[model samples]
Target: MAMIEISGLLLLLLTIFLAGGVWIAISLMACGWVAMQFVAGGIPAGAVLATTIWGNSASWTLAALPLFIWMGEILYRTKLSEEMFRGLAPWLNWLPGRLMHVNVLACGIFGSVSGSSAATCATVAKIALPELKKRGYDEKLALGSLAGAGTLGILIPPSITMVVYAVAANVSIIQIFLAGFLPGLLVMVLYSGYIIVWHMLNPDKSPPPEPAMPFRQKLKESAQLIPCMLLIALVFLSLLLGWATATECAAWGVLGSFGIAWWSGTLTKEAFWQSVMGTTRITCMIMLILAGASFMSTSMAYTGIPLALAAWVDSLHLSPYALIAALTVMYIVLGTALDGISMIVLTTAIVIPMIKSAGFDLVWFGIFLVLIVEMAEVSPPVGFNLFVLQTMSGKDSNTVALAALPFFFLLVAAVAIITIFPQIVMILPEMAFPPQ
Candidate 1:
């Protein structure tokens, strides 16, 4: 059979399995089985499947996923978001957007710890929406800003999405984490900048500025944030300074999260078990998906699908920029249906080769992939962040989707900026772990 025919057959099987409501992991495994059975008839598909799943599952680096997830789960049960709001509001009052900027800053802060976009959105929105609404802030702006900023969860350090991308791309987890920092900050600045411009044009829409806060009073109000700040410093600084590996840092993060929850009096027996259970469920789902993706990737390799696809892309003779433009559109379309992690795992086997063939750095592309995933978090239909805000705001999906539209474009702009100025994504990783 021709490569195109085989690839199309595998694609059809995958689509059919997924459309039939099979679990994503099973769907992937089923597709892999069909490919190996029909296309590579001599190989023992069952043994290959077992070994591939084991190899992917037993990765020490992959240990970071659950620890980071547990940390986020524990902190989500605490009053961290409430404290963030209280601490950040006084500082952000001078900004043109006033307290609305809290959504951006708070999401960034909480996202560093949480790593999950939906969790960050839900945690921050739980505290921010009611407060913003009560303060007479415009509902649309408040909801939209939260929907937009919430995506920072995956772009910042310790991101769950970044961890998955790093493992899949066979790059340094720390390098990917470092690469994401500046781009994440860039997106935040863009979001806040848009908020400022919006407020400037429609000053009447913004609430009156709160009274200037005394420095000491501000300090006192922000004291509750010291622990969270210290935790962030502990996890990130260890990674940056080479004191701990990503997994070690994640372990430390979990310990710090427990301490914070205890100090906040939210670490009750019930909360602890709930966090553990949440961690298990999320970890299991991700691990299964990784295993299935690994098996599928192995099957594709045996059948030469990835190399064939890469050669096809090369034959098109597209410029690097044009290739990136095409990929951005492809990912955006994928985003409309699939969640971010699935997008990364499903495509990396095919996409990474194309990117490498184009001479693009995997670490830089990891950040780019993450930024695109962040956009997916806000994309309609399956956009988890949109669903999060909708549930909290008691609004329909369209309202939440509309609110997130501008930020969606802002993410696209971030993608373009990084594509043109590739240095923005590479500088930190290069500085931290320079080429020999």
Candidate 2:
């Protein structure tokens, strides 16, 4: 009878659904149906469910996810990533942790190109792990950096996760992308810096051997990776300069990837078709999860779940940092169960309202949320990036898990930096796309 009673019941049902099987679509549909009865006083249930799912599923921006994903797939499987790795190998080898630098750089470059963290982890793992094993670099640094570094795929542009978050949370994709650029590079740089500094401080860790490269010869060989550079330049410039929509830029990226593969002589008919198949499969999975998320969001809205929670939290007058700490922990727990995109979808709806209650910038929260979720790629017990690495390397899972620890802290540190500074995530977005 009371609004409080109805809200409490809906929360109970939500918990039960999680226990039953986190079927977001079904959970939302079922919850929305009840909320419509109790909260909205009996709105049409079937019509609402069907209409909401259809409308949310029809978004134009959401389409950019799969296209960018596809582009990354084609480029990665084509060995363009290999070219980039091969080019950087000699240059990076001279440092301590010698070949592990390859893990970081390869992950960074592929993450830039691919836009999917798992793909970046897997793609680079296929190339770098063997070399890492052969060269006697510690497996911990090798797998850990890739597992941690792979998260950059979503932080950087062509990031479907950010794009979808922008669409769902009503933020700007370009702004999110711009917001992420410096931080993403900082993550890459910091990760690489850790390896170099660690090696420098403890010569045993990085034992410097001269990379078998004459500068001129290295320069000449590296030039062969011009296609990888061009691809990176094209995606960033298009988004950065307003030369194209993120979607259009994704399209351009797909075309550019194909061109690069063609030039690299890996663009065989079989590979192209196979890439298409892989893209379709991964994209379909993403879309299915997204469809389910949209439906659940619709249902949750009907129940007033998120709004009620926001109001309740606002009553406490918690400090911004305390609220953020709570949010970070929530994401880490949920992220261990769900993938990065789902974590953003499920949490942003609830978290953004609390964030806004605290008057933190939503754009900043979006970046912060992403940084936290991306950490799952390398985290333990369900670190998807760790598994991707282990699966690729045929190494024991424990070995890969141990390898990933350093980068995990590095990512946590990055999250702390962004959380505290705010400017780290906000400055570029503000500069690129001013407020309405």
TM-scores of the candidates in the order shown: 0.99, 0.93
lDDT of 1 by residue, 24-110 (tens): 999999888888988877999999999999998899999999999999999987666788778988998888989889999999999
Backbone steric clashes in candidate 2, count: 4
- Runs in model 1 deviating more than 4 A are none
Considering summed lDDT, which 10 consecutive residues are worst modelled in model 2?
202-211
Clashing pairs in model 1, backbone N/Cα/C closer than 3 A = none
lDDT of each: 0.91, 0.78
Give lDDT for model 2.
Answer: 0.78
Residue-wise lDDT of candidate 2 within 63-137, one digit each (tens)? 788888889989877877877888888786656676777777777778887888888888777888787777667
Query: Between which residue pairs do clashes occur in model 2?
Result: 96-206, 97-206, 140-403, 144-404
